[model samples]
Target chain A: MDIIAQLFAGLSLGSVLLLAALGLSLTFGQMGVINMAHGEFMMAGAYTAFVVQGVVGDAGVSLLLALPLGFVVGGLLGLLLEATLIHRMYRRPLDTLLVTWGVALVLQQVARDVFGAPNVDVRAPAWLSGAVEIGGLALPRTRLFILALAAVCVVALALALRATPLGRRIRAVVQNRDLAEASGISSRATDRVTFFIGSGLAGIAGVALTLLGSIGPTLGTNYIVDAFLVVVAGGIGQIKGTVIAATALGLMQAFLEYSTTASVAKVLVFVAIVAFLQLRPQGLVSVRTRSLA
Target chain B: MRPRSTSRHGVTRLATASLAALGVVALSACGARVDSGSAAPTTAESCVDTSGDTVKIGFLNSLSGTMAISEQTVHDSLQLAAEEINADGGVLGKQLDVVSEDGQSEPTVFAEKAGKLITSDCVAAVFGGWTSASRKAMLPVFESQDSLLFYPVQYEGLESSPNIFYTGATTNQQIVPALDYLAEQGVTSLFLVGSDYVFPRTANKIINAYAQAHGIEIVGEEYAPLGHTDFSTIVNKVRSADADAVFNTLNGDSNVAFFKEYNNAGLSADEMPVVSVSIAEEEVGGIGVKNIEGQLTAWNYYQTVDSPENDAFVEAFKAAYGQDRPTSDPMEAAYTSLHLWAAMVEKAGSFAVDDVVAAADGVTYDAPEGHVVVNGENHHIAKTSLVGEIGADGLIHTVWSSEQPIEPDPYLEGYDWAEGLS
Candidate 1:
């Protein structure tokens, strides 16, 4: 029963990690640019949820209105960043890295000034505020709700990335942007849409995190490192690899915590991931470039 | 490379290293010349001098994290106390000069700041620590450097470092009294819940032992992660357990979640009461008055503590911050800690860490909490415990009192069942 309970906890936490890293995996791999401010983008989404909740006191009303709001805010922030800064450094990845790092610091400071340093509570809706007990096993209903949300997101994202016209275009861009552009794909518009979608996905992650814990400026930073680990461990650019790595890391964390302190458990996760990365520098899975080697 | 340029780089390296050494020598030398009470030679000495015109102290707190809202009050109160002392012609004719540092709310950062306070800044004593982890991290640095630290937040006891003084109540003085009050009210069974960390785990260990020794039975013990906000499952477990009371040790936003869920589950204070040690005036307001009102909280001081010293403290704090700003237990302890350090320095007659430590055991200060005396053997102090019910005005009304202060016992030595536990 405890192991089963632990698995649920693992799944719940894994979903949050997947949500957090989904945008980073896309932005880093497809665009060939590292978004160091990705976590801060998530922070913006959490704050947006906070403000929306404030205006609408009813939990149901707030959540009902927040999903699209989070996507728009996150997507707009991404668009603004790409237009004003990211586009200039697209060819110079290191310059983009430094610029994004600076942008991250600015966003953090802005959040500190606006929200203050205290952790702000965002209440869960009335409908989701209970737990189920079955044969001596206790489970938070909220965790199950998060799992459902994560599944829906993953499916919708997968279908959008695989089955739709834009999905094929994104895949074409991912495989060979020059070839796709030569074939009339309009790679510039594709870049804009991809960056927007990537950022909006991260914003959705932030909203999920706000539900699990209090909203704070550093909330994104906390998950960002772990998300990078997930992306790196799962093999960058592979969504299937991300799912595998996130679930594995989550299970490892749950097991480590049962035997030691939470801090020690986190340290173990980092160490284990580092060891895994050392063995598989290309990651758990990798894409094939058509060089005959 | 030319030999001349190599020699010049080498000379630059040598000169810079020597200057750093000289800087250290100068700092250690000033330890002998501090301007407070006179008790040491004016030349090179092992101790800091407090006999100068202005005694130097340090205020260390996290100014920028999850702990800032809570720790900032302690910082403000420490300054307030220093100002009040300087106004009264300083301690033993030395006005106070305070050095400040931000701990950044990390354990490693606490150690670095503590080292800087002792070795670089040369403060006579420093005060402030909210989490047990930060205090533990700083303990070795203080001991190795032979500097003094006055930790103001209540913590798990089982500790007695010669160079540090804990002005806040230990489990014996605070948690024990809270349990006793609930037991007196005929709480036949209780549930224990807190954030998953060292302090709460140690606290629950002590609580379980006390419950077994007494007639009370523990229904369940639950813990959430530090920033955890979900409590639906835990709340359901508590409701199913049907304990007469819940002893909550959840810190930060977890409290807000637990309280809201408790209310949502149709649990009220009257049917099965909630007793908390961490939620004070500052936090009660933050957790929302509606969720926490009617619940009981335990602490030594409220903004409503009665006495001339408390009146002065309240008025002066309001004057410093504003009338609407409230005072809580930990901040009062922090203010008292600085004054107590000053009193000990005056008694020892020097800021040399060991000299002041020798005089720390039984030093007394007429503080905001009313005459808390330091126990030199242990680093804790004697403090009265107050059990208060939260009112709509956002202040805790003292409903039960200890009558006299409880002596500091971090290890729970008095209780037979707590044997070998510390």
Candidate 2:
């Protein structure tokens, strides 16, 4: 029974990792942009939830309103970042990493100045407060909600990428930017839209995270590393690979932490990731492209 | 397309990037440890310009970074204390000229700021440090410079410094009384949950010894890194262990996440109450009162502490800051620390460090908590311990308290079970 319970815990944790890393998969993995400020975009979304709650006063209603609002807020911020900075430094990955890191710092400081340097409260709806018992093992409703949310996001994103015209343009640009440009597909516009969707997904993740974690200025820093880890270990640009890697890592972490301490578990997981990457440098999956650069 | 050559180059670049990342990690890990080797104290002459009508004093707190949420309250209270002191004929007839510096939530920054305040700013005395790490980092700087520092936060005991005045509760004052309260309430088993740090690690060690001597069952013990948000697995363990009570020593924003998860896991204060040492009035709002209502907290003071001194402190604090700002234990201790220092300076009739240290013993102040006295030898204050319950109004109401202010026993010298602790 305990083992079953832990398995559920692992699934819940994997959903959280998947939600956070899904955006990075598109921006960093697909676009090859380091996007260190991706976490800040998530922070922006969480704050959007806070602001919406303040205005709406009803937790449930505000949450529903904040989802689309958060996406727009996050998407707009990503668009601005791409237009002003990332577009110019397209090929310079190292420079993009440094600049985005600085942007992250600046965004954190700006948040501190605006919201004050404290973790603000985001009340979960009354319905989401308790757990649903299964075979005498209590599963939290919040975790279940997050799991459902992650699944919905993944499905929506997969459909958008596979069937949508914008997704087709994005894939075309990624495959052969020169050829796509010659064929009259605007790579710049595709890049902006891809970044917008990716960052907007991060924003949605942030709003969901407030149910489980702190909502503070440095909240992004806490999950940024883990998000990147999932993306890297799953194989960049592969959503299916991300999903598999997140689930595997989450299960491993849950079991390790159950037997050992959290600190020790974290260290061991990092070690395992390093060893895994050593064996397969390209990650769990890789995109095969005929294009040179 | 030049695919084969490009793919080869990509693999090499990826390997080099991973190696560089590892190198950075290794270097940062090395930088975490501070050099604690003993060195002879520098007999630096006091540069405090006491001849003028104003005496300079420093207030060092983390104005930014993770700790700023808690430390900012301490900073505001310290500022209020300075203002109150200056209003009451000042310390030794000289108005205080305050010099404030931000620690930036880093211990190394705390040490550097301490040094700057002592040598460069030439302040008579400095006040503020939230974390044990920050205090530990600033300790050597105070000793080496022969300066005075007043730290105002309850911490894990077994440490006493002559150069630093600890105004907050030591182990015997806060944690011990809390354990006693739990034992009285018929809690025979305990599960320890704390952040992985000096304070919690040392605190849990004392609790383990106490539990063994008292015949209480040690159900389980767990620690998470500071700022770590996830607690599902830890909560699962807690539920499985089914201890009589939980002793939480988590600090900062981690508490917010922990309580939320605890409630979400079908656990309530009635079923399995968590006794947290760090959660105070200011933290109640952030944690959401609904999630933590009726939970127990152990501290030296609370906003609901009924006393004339406390009433005035709260009123003045709210008036100065905002009506919404809640006064907490650390902020109260910080407010008291400045007053205690003023009394010490007046008793010694000098602003010099040695004179203040000599006169610090037995100095009492009608602080917000109570009548607190400085134990001259240990430099820790003797104060009452109050166990509080989180009220619906986002404040802590005292549920139990020590009859009198317990004497500071940082080394746990009085307890036979704590013999080898220090």
DockQ winner: 2
- How does residue B97 of candidate 1 score in lDDT? 90
Model 2: DockQ score? 0.51
Error of 2 at B203 (Å): 0.6
Chain A TM-score for model 2, please? 0.98
Candidate 2 lDDT tens digits, B1-422: 21122342263344347435844864463245455324324677778899999999999999986688889999999999999999998998999999999998888788888888988899999999988888888888898888999999998877888899999889999899999999999999999999987889999999999999988897999999877788899999999999999999998778988999999999999989999998888888878889899999999999888999999999999999999999999999999999999999999999999999999999999998999999999999999999999999999999999969999999999999887888
Error of 2 at B406 (Å): 0.3
Docking class of 2: medium
lDDT, candidate 1, B1-422, per-residue tens: 10012121232233233333544743352232222212212332334455568767778899865577789989999999899889888877888898999987766677778777766777778887778878877877776666788999888889999878998889998899999998899888999989877888999999999899888999988777666544545665677788999999988777876786576556788898899989888877556566678999988888898999999899999999989788999999999988898888789886677788888878988887777888878878999999999998879999999978889888889889889788
Q: Give the C-alpha miss distance for residue A55 in model 1, angstroms.
A: 4.3
Residue pairs clashing in model 2 are none
The residue pairs that clash in candidate 1, if any, are B35-B50, B35-B51, B35-B52, B36-B50, B36-B51, B36-B52, B37-B50, B47-B352, B48-B352, B361-B376
Give residue A120's error in model 1 in angstroms.
Answer: 2.2
- The DockQ score of candidate 1 comes to 0.17
Error of 2 at B246 (Å): 0.5
Q: What's the lDDT for candidate 2?
A: 0.88
